[model samples]
Target: MRYLLYALTLLLSSSLLFFVQPMVAKMVTPVLGGSPAVWNTCMVFFQALLLGGYVYAHASTRWLGTRRQSLVHLAVMIVGVLFLPIGFEPPTDATSLENPALWLLGALFLGVGWPFFVISTSAPLLQKWFSTTDHPDAADPYHLYAASNVGSFFGLVAYPFLIEPRIGVQAQTTLWMICYVVLIAAVAGCALALWRSAEPEAAASEASPPAAVLPLSWGRRGRWVLWAFIPSSMMLAVTSFVTTDIAPVPMLWIPPLAIYLLSFVLVFARVEWFRSLPVFTLFPLTLLGLGAMLFVQLGSPLEWVAGIHFLGLLIISLVFHGLMAADRPATRHLTEFFCWMSVGGALGGVFNALLAPLIFDRLLDYPALLVIAALAFPPALYSRRAVQITLLIGAALAGYLVGRDVMIYLGLERSRELATLAAVALSLGIPTVIAFTRARVLTPALLSVPLLISTFYLGQPEGNELHAERSFFAANQVVKTPDGGYHKLYNGTTLHGVQAQDDEFRLVPLSYYYLTGPLGQLFEVLSKRPERHPFAVVGLGTGAIAAYTHRGQEADFFEIDQAIARIARDPRYFTYLEDCPGECEVILGDGRLQLAQMPDERYELIVLDAYSSTAIPVHLLTLEAVEMYLKKLTPDGILAFHISNRHLDLQPPLTRIAGELGLVVRGRDHWVDANDPVYNLYVDGSDWVMMAKNEEAFGAIIDHPSWHEYKPEPRLRVWTDDYANIFDAYILDF
Candidate 1:
């Protein structure tokens, strides 16, 4: 009964710890304007707090008696419950966009900091408490840690699927408070068991075990930190890579994190589950596979790309975590072991989440960590001569590829594709041969040299020329078309906007903003009015919409990223802003917050084009946002939403919100023909939603065969500031 009580206590506390992360982050999205970086910043705070909790557990267990340890922990738990009803109240001064990360941290710390800190101490502290008891499971209390992680995994999965879809944020908070109360009772029960088992001899035996089999050394502690750090960093790096470069599905963070937690469960529950031999074998194969796909641009399906990266991350995590578990100290030093592990985890989070963004120009951290992971695993061969020879050969091959790339850049060679294929082959083949034949200590270094070179090759201009820049928001790139007639802007792998470079058609809007596109049609109808209408664009991507402004018109662009604004304004990269006939103003801040401060009905049209990399900013689509937009528009002004996302079906939510707001919503899907004269020059497929207060204003466009009135799905719930479920908005078939 005592063992069961301890198990339940740890499990419940772990579950709540994971559950509160996503819940609180979702609650605070509106305050931060829904940047993916917000989640990364939250992770840094959580990791730091976790390290603090581990330190507390270590100190209390080392100094206090068993009963005293339990009593102190119970007291802390009671104090933590005082801050319960978990929710964030945005700061009165949060409107400032000077440092959003720090503001977000402050909001999260005040809201759920104490509860999270108290729960973090549970697994290590309870495992120590159980070690002192006379229960049958006392000798090997590590399984309880596994049980704790099992709860964590389920808790994370539950938020997006079971809890979020069914309950509003308020109800979710209430449910969590109920669980916290139950966890308290379980903790008290464990304390009672500790008090009952306090016999003199048993206490003495528990207090001081037999002499240490092997004294703890600094070298061993350093190993513990290294093993823990690799996987922690990898988890964040993979999350950033996939969301920014692959697809920006908000829930993609879950899989890598869940796999990371499951690594701990598997290693602690049964070491045999992750054998070092097989893990080492599969590690190189998967690494080579990922490198090939990244460099070759084989155009593999998105699912396949996601699968390879995710599976590779899982395998790498298992190997590193399994190493840590194998070298764990005796139960007498368990808390100290966990404390150092937490320190390492916090360091990893700091490096990837905080330092990388400020210091590096691009995502150098992801590939840098890949090199570290290779070094973390054991070398396959250790021949001195073989190592030296392999290094020489690898360097020569890398040098040749670099020289060839330079030649291609200078227009001295027309074999760019041939050179790329050669580089890809060397990148994959060299790593495999080294892993198989002469796995030397410098194998990872040799492997890294080629892989880094491959990054430069893969990132080279596939068009006429390429220029890239990295900012706090994302990696931005401008590529001139092969014909040197158009320039395109990209955010990660997704195209944001395009402009023709030819003097004759330089003013034409290309890509999704083509003259015949949905946005184009709306602009045409609005332009028919005699008055010069003031327009506000929420996102300024190459300033494509600026081309539609007439001589008497003016457009104000609210762009969050200064790098994007700079790129759009530069005539060398794009001419839309410079070529515009009307006045243009760029406002740098969160679009929603900036718009709220504007005068009522200040604009004739407001376009919400801020969906970055297919990740919909949910805060901008809620009922509260719709009300705010309406307040900022003229009586008959239209609010246009570019809802062209591959993963989400956003039309239903817009339709539902429009119905509740007593507004008329119309939509059109524009698809250009391949044989059309302007297909690649100025047109692409697009879907847009236009909502307005006057139904008569939409009658002309709605009557066209291409446009239709949007209908709300009966089963879909209206999204508001208090509640939203994105799972319901996902397009499964896409």
Candidate 2:
């Protein structure tokens, strides 16, 4: 009965400990882009604190002994409860946003530090406590630690599915407060158990189990670091590939993180069934075979391709974590072992979040990290002749296909069909041989050969093509097409530029939207006032806005994507340069940053057609950002915000910004007619919000039904770069 109380205490303590992780993380999600980096950074801080807690636990067992340990831990619990309600208090200044990691770490330390430290150390400390108690055959505390993680896994899984969807963020905060109080009271009960079951130590047996020992030497720690680092880094790399290369969706962070956490379940679970030899024996074969497949880029039909890669990474991470878990020591050394592992995890977070973006112009870290992880986790079966033979053949075939694809991409051959077929065959053939032979060592090398080749092929055209293609925040592939003697530039998912194919198309902006809507109407009006008609475009989708410029107007294009600018201005991609002469200049960097950098400038018409809910960078809609836009515009400048969003009703925010800026606003929705040929005469609709400095400008565009008096809702808050509350904005019904 006493041991069950200890067991229940450990379970409840751990449940409270891990439940706060996802709850606090979800609270911070709206402030940060819902990127995996948010979770990774949180893990770094959690692990760092965890290491501290473990060291304290290990030392208490060695020096202070069990009785004193209980007093100290219970005292820390009492102190920790003072900072209750699991949520961060916003920092006092804006500079804190510059390095949110340090701020978050400090905040986490203050808010839950004592409680977490108390609870974290308890896994080991209580186990030692259980061993000393008069209860015969105290089950291994190591198994309870596993039980702790099982509770943790439940917490992680529950947040997104059950808790987050049903409970409001505030409700989550309130619930955590109630849980913490109950958990603390439960711990107090355990402290009573320790005091009541007291024994004058079988003094010989109670003297701390000879200071827990480490199995590995310094050299072995290096190997553990390597083992830990590769899988940790690969987790981030897989997310990059899935999110960027496959599908650039907002909620894409969930799958990769879930996969990464599942590794812990495999590694730490108390169940030993399927936890041993088969994993190690088959590990080499699957590593090389799957590793190679992951590296290869089979283009298009990608709806499920990303899923396949995610699943492959899941298998790899699970395999590695299982191997590590199998080798882990008894309860006494568990904390120390995890402490060293934490170092590797922290390094992985830094490399992916901070270093990779600045170091590589492209997502180079994805394939590179995969290759590294493969090498770090090499299987023990590399000495077989049969495996060696299969690997060599796979490598040779991949080499030939890669060579052929490179030649075609380089214009060495114009036959796209032959090269395409050859590339497909190579991608399939190599994986089959590696799978058949079970050669793990050859898997990484084989996979890497194709991936490296694909990267070069993709990079070569991107590097060399100036006019139609560029990669900045996302890959912008622009293709030129001729329509009725007009030249048009198409961005990956949308058409960006439309002009005459020859000098004829140059003066005529040709798309359905550009030729008929408020933008098209604004162009017609600007033709009469060139000297005073400077126009600023927020996004440089295809440099198409430049095509709308007339003889005397000066235009500056505010483009956030470097890749889009490179391809949009390239003569090969479009005739933006050849057709629209000195009327335009491209300013590269984030639109908000560049505008903030600019001198007091006024545009006759400023386009706020930034993305909204879809791929809309939310930073542009913040009160702070809109204020910057108002500063850069003329007194009568028409602020046209593209409010055409599927999920977000941005008109409210735009209206709020207009009210704050003391301007009047109107909205217009434009579209194309299926049978219109004159194009200019096509009926148009747009949810364009036009804000101005006076009543007359606001009244001028108010007749449209979409137009409404600007009103800000009490619950409808504006988002800023430093913070955004997307949980409030989640349209679950929609």
Candidate 3:
């Protein structure tokens, strides 16, 4: 019963710590540009606070002793509880948006730092306190860490699936307050129970048997930090890449974090046979399989690609953490060990969130971190000359693949058959090398040499890029087509906009806003509107919508990313903003926040292009946002939405929002045939949704065959500021 109490305290603290992460991220997304980096930056802040808490735990245990520290912790918990129901709003001014990462860090520090720091201390401090108790496995309280992670896993898994779908943030906070109050009592009960049995030190001599304790060195401590750092960095990198590139599933960030926590649970459990693996013998297999994904494309499903990489994450965590656990210090130095572990985690967050973006122009952090992970694991398998020979052969095979790119670089004519042969060679060679590389005779240092070489081969930046830039928000590029006929703009993996380079088509819109698309037709339908009110575009993707502005009209473009705004205005890449017939003003800030500040009934037409395939300004599509848009629109004005998602089916949510607000909505899934002459100018298929106060506001387009009325499902609730679930809208693209 006493052990159960200790475990439950650790579990509850961990649950609260993790559950608040995604919830707070959701709150701050609209303010921080809604870039994927928002999550990474938030992680760095939490990891730093967690490290501070661990330091406090270690210092208090040595100086204050268990009895005095327990009283102080109770007081600290009371103080932390005062900062309950954590929440914040988007800053009102544009000054905070100028340095969003630091502003976000400062905001989070004020909002949730105290409670997070207090909760982080519970795991290390409670486990250390339990070690002095008279429980059977008190000497090996590492299992308590496993139970803590079990609770963490539950917290992450529950938020997207169970909590966010049904409960609003306010209600979730209320429930959290109830759970926390229960936890405070549970902790107080633990202190009383410990005192009732005996004083903290009275049973320590009996509970902790005498054993030979080794002296700690900086070198040994560093090994622990490295073990923790690789997994932490890899978790962020994997989540960033997979969410943007591979699966693009809704709530995709959850699985990577879940894998991270589950790895800790599997590594620290007391069952030796299940917890420990011959990691050195199996790690190369995981690495080679992951490497093959870069070179070979056998048309595997998106889920399978994401799964293989996630499996790699799990295996890498197990190997590194398993070794870290095996090197655990005696019970006296346990708190110090955990303190260093938190240091590694904080550094990992800094590297991925702060440093990597500045250092690399492209998304190369994942493969670089993979190389580091390969070298960090100790090679324990045994082999001789045969393994070295096999590795050399594999290196030669990779060289052959590299040679093909060199041939292209050097202006040699390459055949299609040769490309297929090189890919097949790489796919076959990776597994062959993995089989022999597991032997103990080979060193990991030698293994990283080929991977380092392959990073150069497989991870080079794209070619024909006329402009490449990145911001805290996202990485973007402007590339010329191989034929030099058009320029394309890409935001990460999603196409943002495009423009034709030829004089005949220079001023024409392309890609999603091509002259033949639904947007073009909508503009044609609204061409006869009285030229009194101005126009507003939420996102400034290459400023393509500016082409719709007439000589007497005005258009306001709200763009969050400064780099994107610059590229959109640059005539070399895109000229829509420059060549517009009327005035074009670029307002630099979040679209929703900027829109909320404008006067009511201000615009005749409002266009929303703030969504991508996966990452989106979720706050922009809610009931409150729609209501705000309605207030900004004239009685006969129309709202246009670019709903071109490859994964999420957002129509149902918009339909429900329309039903609740008594608005009319219609959409077109426009498919353009490549056989058309417009295809030569870079026109593509697009999906668009348009809404209005009534069918009369849509004018003639409402009756056109290209547009269909949206059907609302009574089962689907309208999304609001407090409740919106992307998981419910996820569509299986593969």
TM-score of each: 0.89, 0.66, 0.92
Error of 2 at 643 (Å): 6.9
Candidate 1, 538-640: lDDT as tens digits: 8898998999998867899988777888999998898788889888888887778778888998888999996645356788889999899999998879999
**Which runs of model 3 end up more than 4 angstroms from their true locations?**
199-213, 296-300, 381-442, 674-677
Give candidate 1 regions above 4 Å deviation: 91-95, 199-214, 297-300, 380-443, 446-450, 458-467, 482-484, 502-504, 612-614, 732-734
Task: Report the number of backbone clashes for model 3.
Answer: 6
Residue range 143-201, candidate 2, lDDT tens digits:
55555556566666666667765656677767877876776777677767777775534
RMSD of every candidate to native, in Å, equals 4.4, 7.9, 3.6
The better candidate by TM-score, 2 or 3, is 3
Clashes of each: 1, 22, 6
- Which run of 10 residues does model 1 get worst, by summed lDDT? 203-212
What Cα-based lDDT does every candidate model obtain? 0.77, 0.59, 0.78
TM-score: model 1 vs. ground truth: 0.89
Q: Which regions in candidate 2 have their CA more than 4 angstroms from the true location?
A: 1-39, 86-139, 194-215, 280-303, 381-734
Over 1-734, each residue of candidate 3 has an lDDT whose tens digit, in order, gives 98899888888888888898898888888686456689889989989998999999999988987667888888898887888878786787877788788989999999888888888898889887777666667676878999999889988888888889889888988888777778788878777665655534544533332221545889888988998899999999888877766645537777888898988888788755433555444576566556555544222477788888888899888877777777777777879989999999899999998998888765667778878987777655323343354455555656666566667755532343344445455546654666655555345665565555545544444546798776787778888887888788888778888887787777788889876689888888778776557889988988888888888788999988888899998888898899888799999888888998999998988999977543777789999999999899988888998878777777888888988988899999987788988677678888888999989888889899989998888888778888887765656564
